[model samples]
Target: MADRVASDHESITTVRATLARRGSTSRPAIELPDEQSSSSPDSASSRRDADAFPAGEVVRLVVDGSERHAKIEEYAGDRSIPGAYDAPSMARDPDSASNRLVEWADDKGLELGQSVLVDVIEEGFKYGVREPGERVFYDATEAPDDSLASIAQQLEDN
Candidate 1:
């Protein structure tokens, strides 16, 4: 078996996720629920939000000053949970598909109603986690606009 490797990249965005306790013991300690006004027909049983968190992609989670790899997944869409869209959950591996946030939260002594910062490392692929606080931004170079301009400059000929 090969050991897991880490990737180098900057976070795209950080989300302040408020924690909520799950009703069932079988479920994770918290449910990072995302409720939308409408349903996404294109979304599948997993990777509900491909633009943000892609399933099977590894993410670096910084919990309690420690870093770990986690996979992003969305299970609500599969179960047909109403108003739930792109609700990402972390897993250690593909087989069990369990939420890693639960264990991390327990280790950090985090409770329900608290907020956690989930940083998007590579758009849909990678991400990171930390304590929620002020918003942080990464240094990035903006790509030049390629679209046509609405107003064209008039050319003068001799």
Candidate 2:
């Protein structure tokens, strides 16, 4: 009985240590829209409206040294939800956002790794290389001059 207890204690300690390490290294969760909803007519119409809006911005990121483009409005999560309890809760699953991006890329015949360096190019938002898997939360409050050149410049600096 004592031996079993000791072994269990050791296992618990190892698990705790692993969790702590992951917590420290983990990036913020990326929130992607549900695939099912994205195909609905309502969602499609909304997407068209968003594209027509002047506030729409396009962000470009270098995935494996190649330029990849994604609409800022597509992955920015639902803005309707207020505050911390938003549509894509950052606390849900660390890989959710990254996986979504990877899946999208894969569908386009582009391969992405477990980690990716993202350069966000939305206007009015501070341009920078987002942490791996962080682009899903990318958002902008005001529209700026949308420029693909600026994104390329930021990527060069990184």
Indicate which candidate wins on lDDT: 1
Clashes of each: 0, 0
lDDT digits (tens) for residues 1-158 of candidate 2: 13222111211110000001112433222222222222221111111222221133333323333333333332243211001111122213223334333333344443222322222223223222222323222222233343865675466556
Tens-place lDDT per residue, model 1, 29-120, is 32333642132111211122445655444444544444444554456542111111122222432344444566666766777677655554
Clashing pairs in 2: none
Worst 10 residues of 2 by lDDT: 13-22
lDDT of 1 at 140: 32
Clashing pairs in 1: none
Report the Cα lDDT for residue 5, model 2: 21
Deviation (Å) of 71 in candidate 1: 2.3
- Alpha-carbon lDDT of model 2: 0.26
